[model samples]
Target: MSTNATTAQSPFDPDKSRIGRVLCFAAHPDDIDFGAAGTVAAWTAAGVEVSYCIMTDGDAGGFDPEQRDEIVRLRSEEQRRAAALVGVTDIHYLHERDGYLEPTHEVIRQVVRLIRQLRPDVVLAMHPERNWNRIQKSHPDHLAVGEAVTRAVYPALENPFAYPELAAAGLEAYKLPWLWLFAGPEERENHFVDVTAQVDRKLAAIHIHVSQHPDVEAMERTVRGLMGQTAERAGLPAGRSAEAFHVVTVNGPGTIAGF
Candidate 1:
């Protein structure tokens, strides 16, 4: 089934994408690297403007408790290199503590500011909804960033009255036409992006996160297997890879699943 701006269930096909600009909002430094780096590479290769907004510094992301500060510096540098690998240069870090994220008013306001400033045609974020069987998909930081970005996409962006300071600062309300939630609840994968040609680039980006994934061979197999599963689900041809997503309808009847 083909997809367009009008429908939510169809895949977020980069070929048919009307979106000129995109902002990928993520929890940790390497979240998008693992999940959507191929899609980002493809979108950039197609000349679509893409920016990354990583909410946390990822200080708590690694196994080594001894190299805390060094890990932060290493992860930040790694993320920049990884982003460049996929042709994404505009990377912003929000410096929030990795494990202590909560979707507070301040977090919402900060994300709202970023959303207004970037003004992407579509916002890509993690789905706050959890997958009980896959606990890794439901990381607290991911949920916090997702919820904060979701809030920014809705009433915060739709209602200028909600954030009066933003209006006073000349950053008025802005509506996001599309919200694509990556790594959603297991059954919520209604959208996908074919990454057949860019899967290698995705692997390379994930490789840059050496602090978290020192075992490259095992990581490769794990990631490739996951992407292959997604491709299978999307009905793509054998050897193809895909990134999955859940499309959330904004200002519609609650979540797309709510109705």
Candidate 2:
């Protein structure tokens, strides 16, 4: 593995950055932990504020249908604990029932409000586009939430006139500069954040989601392997680990963006 991102560049693309506030939206409680918690830890360590805005309680994630209410409470607590491990205390759980999310105007309105209120420099969300390689796990809820978040970030949140009600309520439009999409198709310009130092924190966070992953040790190993694979693809050393993201310039010039 090598660490020569500059040498292989074709043109200017979004680069890996850790700055300001970052708002992450996920379909379920464990989605961010499973996909980008290491990167989140790394960002927080850099003094960046991170918030988790989850769409569902993940009550339908488990098979034990009889314990729905209990599972909901347990999962929410677990997610909070997991997020706190990485210095993330702002966790918003949207009460949409699991497995029934739709990319409707209502969903976009919900996320747009958060986007305007939080006013984050960067937004992290699941990829709205389906990845052919991850066909099996591209759940409908994930797709819907992803689409909603994406819609909110663009013309919806940035356009002051798009939602007069939010503006009337003192939630000003926020022109988000960058966005990072996880679990999506990989490209040459994608950013791979080296999270070698935060792997322990990330694994610990994942461990706290006990309801989702009961075998902590197995989850740790799997996470390490996945991050290591990302590092290898980014041309890093064998022992190094990374969290991958496909970042894009949203409302700003790609070349001039600070990130």
Candidate 3:
């Protein structure tokens, strides 16, 4: 839908919020684009700093083992290119084994350390509270990464006592109260962004993941079609492209003050 039509009362203002640093944690390489690249694009266009923390190297994402390492390398490059398209400069690959992630203490500690180092104003991640029945448990890694990131956002990053090494490394305690979790089955989303203005940029970013470009393109078309349907359903302007998000307040006092 056109951004003007979707404009409603909400606290999220891409123009006002100075997103000094943004940390986006995704299950795989391309998950960020699928979930919230449009918003990321908008944020970066407004000069907000953006960074990506990919949970896996995607070594097992493809069908061939003979060229798996090469494939992973190329995928990482693609992710970097995609980040650039969205005006993001830094991309961190955790180098964890793909498709084999587990919510171990080691993993939690690593995520907590990254959060502490980045000191981001906003964090985006896969929805841990997604409807379990509908979720594809086939990818246990996705679930594991999501759960770990969720846990690390709070006490792990905010609690000074949780990880002593972080403080030792000169990383002070910081809290990211604003979090956006996508793909949840029952999230309370009161905001919608008219990405019509930024749809091409979003598509260009998605196209960077060459391994998933075909699938990503198909999904983008589907999303556009769905936006059209949503417009028609609402008796608003049809054929308008858009993106949706579920804003979750994770820490202290939340407010829709500027909406």
Candidate 4:
């Protein structure tokens, strides 16, 4: 995690011609919808093939205790619906238990397999660094997923010798060029996507997770305020909304040209 990213750093610029595929990894079902659905919508609109890999089925989420038994199925369906709204349909569920995720070798291998199978140019994941300012974003599950995926993206993905079983299974080693991390410390953010045009779709996606939000209206307001703040920090014009990320070029610099 201490790789000096000076040469690997860049802003948000997924040129459609160069960036063909993206793989988004999240700890739970609604994580992507809340953090990067708008940016995902924008990417899909530009014909980028985007896929999701949710580490957990969000069994520990939701406000109701009565539906605990069915939470897994409920959240899966909700996540699929939400992802569809933003033009994504291929979602891989690892089915890991929620609330107790860890950055173990098995999880990292699963992620590496998906990255090889997808061969995505960019992989969007949760930030590994704890967000001290936003305690909720630093959920244990989120941190674990971030660390696991980061490990998968680094030496594991590119080094053909790291995981022999994967290669034996025909999932050849692939190198990911870019990594974008969200829900991280604001000071670490180096990229901003102006998602003003896709805010409605983002909110709609979030609303699809009915079990998670008891007060949808309040959640929408809070999300708007947060996105607005990001827009202001990105120096976007007033009335604009944006999503922020800490971009990391995993392979080398000059892979993605910033806008």
My TM-score estimates for the predictions, one after another, are: 0.91, 0.88, 0.82, 0.92
From the highest lDDT down, the ranking of the candidates is: 4, 1, 2, 3
> Per-model C-alpha lDDT, please?
0.82, 0.79, 0.71, 0.87
Total backbone collisions for each predicted model: 0, 1, 1, 0
Q: Which stretches of candidate 2 lie over 4 Å from their true place?
A: 1-18, 63-66, 254-259
Candidate 4: which stretches are off by over 4 Å? 1-17, 253-259
Which number leads on lDDT? 4
Number of residue pairs clashing in candidate 4, backbone atoms closer than 3 angstroms, sequence gap of 3 or more or interchain:
0
User: Per-residue lDDT for 78-130 in model 1, tens only?
Assistant: 99999999999999888898899999998898888888898887899988888
lDDT tens per residue, model 4, 61-119: 99899999999999999999999999999999988899889999999999999999989
User: What residue pairs are clashing in model 3?
Assistant: 10-259
Q: Which pairs of residues clash in candidate 2, taking residues 3 or more apart in a chain or in different chains?
A: 2-235
Backbone clashes in model 2: 1
The lowest-lDDT stretch of 10 consecutive residues in candidate 1 is: 1-10
